[model samples]
Target: MLQQETALQKLWSWLFENKVMLLFLLICVGGVAVSGNSASFVIENVAIRFGRNAFTVMSLLIPVLAGLGLNFSIVIGAVAAQMGLFFAVDWGFNGVMGMLIAFLIATPLAMLFGFGVGRLFNKMKGSEMIAGLILGYFADGLYQLFFLYILGGVLPVKTESLIIPGGIGIKNTIDLTGNMKYALDEVKLVDIVLIFFIIIAVISVFRIIIKLKNKEQSPLKDLIILLLAAAVYALTYVPAVESMLMTSKLSLLNVFLIIAVVGIAYAIWKIISNKLNPDPKFKAIRYITIIVAIVLLYALTYIPELEKILMNSKVSALPLALIAGLSLFNAAFLSTRIGQNMRTVGQSRVIANASGINVDRVRVLAMIISTVLASWGQLIYLQNLGTFATYGAHLQVGQFAIAALLIGGASVSKATNKQAITGVILFHTLFIVAPEAGKVLFNNAMLGEYFRVFVSYGVIALALAMHAWQRKKKPSLELPA
Candidate 1:
């Protein structure tokens, strides 16, 4: 009976912890059903939306880690990206070169904007979130002033297409169709793979050097993992495998099979590693759960309708790689000294300061990093979108990204890479299906649009409220006399 009670408690805890994710998952499933959209259509739309928005959403993570809550000031970073794009277009830079130049221009400008925002946040401290929101509005005004009064009026631009009739202000919309459309997305898959290999090799060499310098044991495990991964990648070179992969769209079942194979391999590795060095903390239940999930996913691929949807979805290779890279970076950053400082500062400024860490500096660094990332994310979004909305493109960036993060069960004090990725998928899935669902149920597509917008704002508000309530309920530390 005691054991049963403990098991029940554990189940309850898991449910409570994952309540938001589970709810969103259910809503997405229900929305898809009600919308009556074909699975293929939804899958295709979600794949495109994910490529466009994932990076911007992930950009919010660092500020949250530093206890700055949602960085609404990411709009400022978006502005910097637009400015770079403007220059890139005005100079007649096109294709991949244009995108690269825009990135180069955006980076320093974003850094500058991020630095200023960081300083302001340090002063605002407890109210950094609100301060950032207001700063975005404030920055927008300056942004308009520069583009309207200064860009063409004070500083002439060569591009007539970008200038208004009176030539005083820049146009409200800039077409990137010829200049930078599909710049990143059109990158050859082979180039991306080659770059990935080079990056891995570089990192491996660096790690070996560090190990040697420290007189530590050789990183045999790391080398083994790298070799194993390379071996798997090499299988793609087989004529049959290569021909299949070269197709415009891959079968959904194949994708699931690939993932299942990787998961099974990892699970086997864990079992062997556990045998060699037993860990009390290791739980076989996790592997069991993962295997179950893989099985379910694989089973879904066997369903005809689901299979069609999966096969029909075409993902952009470079953008997907970038998203994965950013996720990996988030995980890697958290293990670094600076990331630890951000975490420490986030937990309690008083404690962080007391521990001789410069809390203000850490917070500033976090904002700077977040802002710079937001700039790059905006670049990715615009390049994929193939058009630049000079004035309106960035307006909803912060709100939507923050909402997505919050919807994924992230709070003001805590978030993770997994939560951010999951939130993007769920939030965007709802975004894609909600309007159709609304139209189906209520005969009004607008209603669905309103509902999704409401969900975006509502989720953020709910997270904030929950955060405040939790703080109030938390017990304060009391020193004994």
Candidate 2:
């Protein structure tokens, strides 16, 4: 009996240690097994579907890192992305050009809205997440007013097709396939841009590891890392590399390979140069060169493609995922940082004041950022669906983003980029497949939608419960007498 109990304890300890990987593996296996005979088809279909969804999921990364609690305001970015799509479609902007133009158009709106949300979250402090969540709901009402009523009645939307048959209101749904459909995926421009972002993330991780390796060392390693990063950017953007990318299959794998080679070469070059002479002034020049090179390369690659596509495609209600992802990331990160500061102020405004951090500034920033992310999120969502359902479209965004984040393993007080991505993938996978999974077993597709909703909400509840349980487990030491 004693031996059995000891073995059971050991098993429990092992499971706890490998919990995240174990859970992820379980989800993958369970998802596949549920597909039964069509599992391969189902897996591939879902994975491709995931690519369609990845941009939006990635949008939540910055906000989570900044501690903003899922940026419920991502709807704002979505909405702004929609406006760009709407105009692009109206003007007959096709494919890659439309995507780029739409992205450019959405940027200003995302910044404005994100700033507003950041301010609001800053005011709420400890309740930033909940505050942002509610704010998203309020913004939805405003979004509906603009999208459903104002645009057709007073705003003079140029395209007749966008307005309703009544001629005084917008339609319940607008088809956007003609303008901005699959712009990002279809555009075969510099594969390095995609790889650049991924490599930046990798280099970021490597820098962290290096920091841990030599905490006692001088700040020289940072300069080396920065120089390497810049070199990678410069090498990847060299005009000659663009031709090579053009010949290769325009796939994510190809993009990744190019980025890996560029990063390796850049790292080696920087390491050798730093060993030869470590000057801060030279380091700054390297940084500037990398930034300029990347900018020039991106412009050289996408500008022409965008110009050509802007002349062709037209989609009214399109999903501008590419643009929204970038905007939301910035907004979420800013708001999260401001909100964290606000929490510190809330814990003791006097101490925070003494430290010279302006509480009001933090609050304002939080509000702005949150609002911007929300705006972009709405835009991306509307464009992707290719239509808007009057009252129903924006209604679920706050709940969905929040629910998705929590489902992915986020909490009210803390979250991470990995959690946001993992949650969205799993949540979306379940969302995409649940209906079919249900139909196969129960012969009813509606059951699948209900199952998805139930699971989404259930996941949030589970995360909250787990967080509370974890908090309870922390032993409190009595104050010394």
Candidate 3:
């Protein structure tokens, strides 16, 4: 019975890990049945509407990577994007040109915002997650001030369409239809731009890290890992009787990224492997296996049916870049030697000083990274949404993003990309279906809204309480031991 229970526990953990996929499946089935009366319309409408939402959802993955929590302040990025849109409107840069210009403008703003937020977070140290959540609220107030009081009055907001009726500030919502709608719809194919950029970025970063580590660390094991990964990517990109173009074209940039990543990994592996005297043959097997695994990884994307369903969908390249970039930020915070130093400084400046790490410098860098990711995420999210919420736009952004992440199973001290993605999917799915589901089952859509609010708050409370409880229990457990 104990063994059975243990097995069940393991199964439960696995389920938790894959909760998003499970929830997605359940929602699809239940959604279909619930709306079966108009299944076709529901499918067509929901897919189109939600597809527009994918980029924002994907944006949440970045701060999670950077170990900055869920980045509820990503709305800062959105605000930056909105500022761009506003400017584009002023300049009469219509359509794609306007959208492109907005994107360009948002980039610097995002970076600036990210740098500031990152700095603040470093100061807060252990409390970065909660700090970020609160920061979102503060930023929202600023956003509202700009949108409400400044834009039309102090700043030049020329277009009546964008301005409010009284003419002091911008309208509650700007009509994005003619301005920036589907600007990149053509030149930015879901395939070439989005996938290519992601693959290239991921591969290059991974390779560079591995290579750098190899120079100072171990070699054979790292080499094996790189080779195996290369094999996987190579295999996936290989053309059959059909042309290579027919296959998933691995972009040159992606190839570069992959090389950089493998290089870095190799360097790291060699260093680690050298510290432990393992059999030389074990090292050889390891490299072979590493190459094979990477090859397999890239190859996995080649399945015709799966690729058709997943890869064929058009997505923006910007979000992918943001995710990759933010993840590196998180990686820096979490696992890196520098990251450990940051934590040390956060815990005790005196001790960090004693340990010989530059606490002040580390703190600054941490802030810069966090804020930059925040800025970028906000931009991606706003662009993806193609609209702004005005006073309430950035208000609960930090809260909701943090709540969603925790609900999806991240604790304050530890979060991962997987958790952020899962949380966003589940949280958004609930956002979509709950009201309707409530209306269908309970007779009032508002009930679903209430349920959502309850769950959102409940998750945050639960996560915080859990953290406190664990902290309290640690002393007791250690005392007995």
Candidate 4:
């Protein structure tokens, strides 16, 4: 009976820990079913939405790490990107060049905006989240003022398309068709692969040199990884492979197979390396779990409906690659010195200060990095969308991103790249199907739209409430009188 009670408690803990994710998963499944959308259609929409919004969502991570909850001020970064886009379009730049110019223009402006936000956050230390939320609104007002009065009115601007009828403010909407539409998405997958290969090669070589300089063990593992990467890059040049990549879309089955192969290869490499090195950190259970997951995924592909969807659904490669790169960046950043400092400060500003760390500077740096990334993320979002809503594009960015992050099981004091990516997938999946699900269930599409919007805000509020409740429940350190 004691053992049974312990087991039940453990199960309860597990359920409590994963309640949000499980709830979202159930909703996604039910919504997809009720929406009456084909599996392929849902997958396609989810993939596209993921590509469009994942980066912007990711831009919230750094500030969260620095103890600034949610970084709602990232909307300022979005506004800066829009400003850059406006000037880029006004200057007659097009294609990738326009995107590049916009990025260059936005980077400095975002840095400036981020600095101010950081200073403000520092002043309002414990209340950074609320401060950021208010800051976003304040920034939006300034953004409107600039676009409405400063652009064509105070400044000399002859761009007819951008100017309003009264010729005082910028137009409410700016079309990016022919200019920067699909600019990054249109990049050849082969080129992206080659660039990734080269970066990996360079990093590998650098690490190998450092190892040799220190007279440490041979970098056999690095060499093997580089070789594997090179082989993958080489396959891209094969006529059949190249043709498949050049096509606008790729089969989800092929994509899944590729992922499975990569996973298997990694497992094999880990096993071999473990046998050779006998690392104490190796976990048999973890590998077993991974192997089981891979097998289950492959088995699911055999189901007739799932198989049809997997074979029929296609996804673009470049945007996915970009998202993967950003995810990697987030992971790698945490291993660096600044990331360590940010983590230290996040855990305890007093301790961090006692450790000789400049908490304010670190927080400022975090905001700058987040703000710049947010600017770039907004650019990616707009280019794919091919339309810039001058006055409104940046409005919901902070709220929606924060909501997604919170929905993915992240909290005020802790977040991870995995959580961010999971949140993007789950949150966007709900966004994609919720309206249709609502319509089917309630006979009103507007209800679904309202439901999704509500879920976004509701999730954030729930997470905040939970955080407060947890804090309140924690045992105090004071001794009894």
Winner on lDDT between 1 and 3 is: 1
Candidate 3, residue 342: the lDDT equals 66
Q: Give the TM-score of candidate 3.
A: 0.63
- Pairs with steric clashes in candidate 1: none
Candidates 2 and 4 compared: the better one by lDDT is 4
Taken over the whole model, the C-alpha lDDT of each candidate is 0.83, 0.58, 0.58, 0.85
Q: Give the residue spans of candidate 1 off by over 4 A.
A: 1-5, 207-255, 444-448, 466-481
Off by over 4 Å in 2: 1-28, 37-39, 61-68, 191-244, 247-353, 366-393, 440-443, 474-481
lDDT of 2 by residue, 1-481 (tens): 2233466666765554334434644754675567463543444444454444544555554455444555666666666666666666656676667666776787777777777777666667567667766776787778778777777688777778777787666676666676654444444434535555566657666776677688865546665666676776566577787565453223323333344556456756775687699865556456446645655654543556443432233221123234334545554644665555656654566777888888666545544544454554554455445555655665566566666666666665555556665666666666656666666667677776786777667766666676576557433311223
Instruction: Give candidate 3 misplaced runs (Cα > 4 Å).
Output: 1-75, 94-97, 114-135, 184-187, 190-340, 343-351, 470-481
In terms of lDDT, the best-performing candidate is 4
Q: In model 4, where is the ten-residue run with the lowest total lDDT? A: 472-481
Q: What is the lDDT of residue 421 in candidate 2?
A: 59
Quote the positional error of residue 44 for candidate 1 in Å.
1.7
How does each model score on TM-score? 0.88, 0.65, 0.63, 0.88
Worst 10 residues of 1 by lDDT: 472-481
lDDT of 3 by residue, 235-353 (tens): 54445523433432333235434655675588558756765876555555566566667666666546675454343343334444445545565655467787677666655678988
